[model samples]
Target: MASPTLTLHQYQTAASETDRTRTTKPTRFLLLGLFGEAGTLLDEVKKKQRDSGSYVGYEANVVEELGDVLWYLAVIASRMKLALSAIARPPEQSISSYATADNEIRFSDLQQQAHLPFAAPTSNFEITLLRLVAAIGALANAQQQSLPEGDEWGPYLREIFHILIQTANEAGVTLENAANENLTKIFDRWPEERHFPPLFDEASDIAEEKLPRHLEVEIYERTVARGPGIEKLYVLQRCSGILIGDRVTDNIMEPDDYRFHDVFHYSYAAVLGWSPVLRALFRLKRKSTPKIDEGEDGARAILIEEGVSTFIFAYAKQLNFFEGQHEGDLSFTLLKRVREFVSGYEPKHCPLWLWEKAILDGYAAFRFLQRHRKGRLILDLNNRSLSIKAI
Candidate 1:
């Protein structure tokens, strides 16, 4: 029938004198890189504590470092070209931010929903780290001339949920469920499980073998270039293991420091002869998480939540929306070429232009990049759904 105004769903183009603000992506990367430095600093501080055996004396610096980490984050957004206008409403106004104050409050409400054990303040280093990271995304929102009288979490929180859900689905796991269950049990909001899922045994094998199929790839590559928002959470959930209460923390303190086994519960099926730790990590739990990262609510919130009124962004290497390949026989070996990029890599080195197009126009978003295709590419089902303009 009629052509659509926009090809897919994602952040709209910027338009305005205020929208002219630059230095957003750089801010985020700055904070991310700074955090890496902070982690190193934390490491050194810990080593000093161990050597001097006087960590209690330096307890205050620990807190100071946390604030420094967040401050760096706040400023990084400034460097990445993030601006108040971007978060409110654009200058020329391409997309309608689509966020509401009601949604902004959810970030705070999630913490109050149920009881969580040993829960730290929303300002805790871990929680604050994510919020600050997510907040840097304030610029991703459509900028506006004026803001309402009272506003809390800011607009960036909405994106965390959006990206969390999608990536969780693609990676094929229930870290979210574990996230929910842990909060429920620890907070006493819900009863505890009588038994723990068995220890995963197949993660290593799957790591070496390959991942499975996903449907959203077509839509994602078509839409975003990973400019901002939930894409942050999506990347986090994929690479690092997420945890909430003691259950989650305890899980991560396993044999070594591997939480993927606990969250995905994949390794449970590795069976002595079947696979390795990496492969087994992908087997235990194949169930997907919700559509967004609601912080403490974890997975149950997803099942109970309603329509998606939030906003998000993503990044992709290519956009071949028209994957005419056999439905069951898609994916490729190159899919494995991006473990670091897809999971845990974050947007440190990813391009916003690519993420924006992937989340909006799908594979077709790679029109400019496609000109460099050395030759037609081949399709192989061994890998997950990936690549653009396959031969």
Candidate 2:
């Protein structure tokens, strides 16, 4: 006579039952849902601000929307087999402390001048979504996991959950209802596991038809640029360091210097590819032994790699790439953006010009983050923008 109470794990399993009958990829479906739901949440927040001239009147409404975002985040974590506790765990050290003195001073000044509690721009929600997506892409690369087929969504999901949890906590939203209600709604929608028509077929069709034309390398090159403080950019073959494309700020380096830097970048990429953390996270089976090449850089560099290609950014000096006080922390956000670009890249018709454009896009993304000191870069096909969050 009594109704059943669902545990988080049980809720995840029940809600995902319809996943088995669907033809769409799990990650892709989840991504679409995640983005759509996030967009909806952002839309609601924007509407409240525009209609009422402030968000104070719509606090409850915004909290409800945040719950919706959290629902999608929980489902994503469930599909990835990640525990909510793990996702909600904070890093031992925060990344903001890793900033250079100048950066720290600048951030401190911004914090002091901020009026809003979160100090984020009006479009904070949208930018947060972009950052989350970029983080997913980066985690995939660091773990050597590919999109759609990759089973290692745990780390990515954990990161998303962290963001959602932080946002909800800051807003004073209680998530218990949101989680339960979402599962109940999903179970009702799928009910008995009957097949329903695909919801995104037309969207997919349009994307397939237009993606190539819109994402042409030439078009990207024309639109994307190295914003500022970008000394050099290189697109090289993942292991070999054979140059695929490059944009230099100054004259070319000596042949020996170039080779040394190639080797250094390659080594870093290899470590990322073969990292134990990545391996364990994705459950990757080793296919071949990793090869190491000897070589060298004075300037600080960050390497973001895909299956076949790598994008290397060379900065003028050593900037802390990690988030927290730990110097070892890597810039997961930047890595994610690069991976997102690389994964969506069409290689068949790609030329040097296209590679140049892609590299420029990477530069632009890095420059934006560096300038704002707090924000995520979003690249929507040919359109590129920075989502600013107050430090």
Candidate 3:
């Protein structure tokens, strides 16, 4: 007797049925199962290599783990409205066809494949599987000298597919989508194929235009003012962490404001290290840009930075004009005026009170500008103008 071949749709249905008793959080549940099973598979491989100095007799265990990984992958595909067959099949016009005469796959070929709007595996699952294939190829090349010649790539391919499928399921991403998004981003960073450099390096001489733009520009016809609920505003030097200037409503101050200001700066910097995909998904824009941080207590913090040198941190009791468009405009205006004031007035000669007064006057000017119903107020510094176009 021989075992019957299972179709892709049938396998997906079976996998979904097996996990029907679990929680409704399919994404989280599938991810945990995929990684947990993969970890077990890797552990078995490691144990065999450590004890026997090779993975000779553990082939059956590896196959079983790979099957387990595939099962989870099928379930995830079902959740994402994708069929396993769709991911398994190669495109009609394959990317490999465009390879150089020597069969060399250049970065340009990868970019061209990514930009093909009609390409198959446009979803995340398909793209991920392709990456797994690449990994398997690399592994085979490295082990060519040690491994047997006959069917040498078979086990390696299976093992990679198992890992790739499970990992993609866990991340709630399809390989195709991830690859396409990444390729687009890479193209943006390196428009020319010849300009693509090594993946990892410490060289900082890359052209500024080659970098991804994180700066956001907001233009408004009218400017508003921070109302009664406005709390504390602090101007801090980013690199030195010095409190350059501050203004408090009612002349009242909270001791925690200093700590909050410091933590906010560090937190913003930390978030910049996150992947572009995660950053875009979560709407985590760059630091120093105007953004609102809301707390559970109905309070909000309006944060803005001036280039990389200074940051304006403001806290408000409510999410009103203080934490909205007005704050963004005012913060930039105040930062420009304050930076100019500090540059000319010798800190050693000027009293601390005078510096504080300068900041207060800037705040006062921002408030006055908000009162104008119709007019343009332009502040030209160093030939750059922050203009209120119209109201």
Candidate 4:
């Protein structure tokens, strides 16, 4: 069966649902974001030009950037009380001769119609992209001079719609595909409502395979002598008064207190309800099912979890361990890279917000342990929170 038809009207309506900006000047905010995303698209192309063959992932990046541009266009048109389906098809005659302002075209009808004249490529990818950006700039300039809910706005809007289609064609991207991907990413990052996903082991009948919903762990440090004149600082973690993981040292020439990094796994468990490393350490592997045991909670999954913890730690270290930063402050690049790290793993099911919470809260706990040298790391999965208390 064919995938259900998607129209510009439907896409515009869906995109509006994800708008988080509540500024009094929404037009300015939307236009500014439009320009910034366009510039980012250009920058990505610039890198492709500078790096040539080494610049892989250009197509994927273009799809994402173009999808963002489409979102802005849709929202801007809606903001101006214009139907995206109507704006999508520029009038063949002068703007004054076009249908009345109240007249709206059904987007479903647009799906039945053949590709518009603008869909034909007028220039190369670079030239077409430049024209599209220039068209947006022209629209923004026009918006400042006159109120958008008037006849003066129609032509500029139509021109932008025209050039945008051509630009996508020149880049060999399907507009519907772009819109679909945009919705997928938007919902993944910011859903209609926030709710904790069910715990990973919620369905397991075996108690040993289930992660503790409430866990209080003790993390402290001690100095031990390996040689006559040398002593090393080590961090140890325990739970329920029993030693859990082995003691760890920084294992680096510099003392960054990385031995306390287990806080990251704790946070992941608490916030995301998924952490293969912890499952392995706590002997909670779901061994009743071979696939769940060897694949989901297995060695490879554990490695991926450890890799994500270390990767995020390296990123946080450069930004003062994300100190004083709140949600949405972490760079999308960092989060996207992390998503890539666990692309095939079970943890990838968690949303970006959960990952952000895990990282920020984990670093907060890590910083606390670093300062006090010992603390209780608390994991409350029911509450979806992690916190530290100094000992």
Using TM-score, give the best candidate's number.
Answer: 4
Q: Considering summed lDDT, which 10 consecutive residues are worst modelled in model 2?
A: 292-301
- In TM-score terms, candidate 3 sits at 0.25
CA lDDT for candidate 1: 0.27
* Model 4 stretches astray by more than 4 angstroms: 1-10, 24-29, 39-59, 78-83, 93-123, 140-153
Better of 1 and 3 by TM-score: 3
**Each candidate's TM vs. the true structure?**
0.19, 0.33, 0.25, 0.83
Q: Could you tell me how far off, in angstroms, the CA of residue 268 lies in candidate 4 after the best superposition?
A: 1.3
Candidate 2 vs candidate 4: which has greater lDDT? 4
Off by over 4 Å in 3: 21-23, 53-57, 91-391
lDDT of 3 by residue, 74-186 (tens): 56555544445443433442222111122122222222233223221223533454455455445435454564422343344335544464444433333344333333322
Score residue 119 of candidate 4 by CA lDDT.
24
Worst lDDT run of 10 residues, candidate 4, spans 113-122
Ranking by lDDT: 4, 2, 3, 1
Ranked candidates (TM-score, high to low): 4, 2, 3, 1
The TM-score measured for candidate 4 stands at: 0.83
Candidate 1 has what TM-score? 0.19
For model 2, state the Cα shift of residue 146 in Å. 2.1
In candidate 2, which residue ranges exceed 4 Å CA deviation? 1-7, 18-26, 53-68, 74-85, 93-152, 192-391
lDDT of 1 by residue, 117-185 (tens): 321122233343354345434433322323331222234422333333222222222222323322222
Q: Scored by Cα lDDT, where does model 3 land? A: 0.35
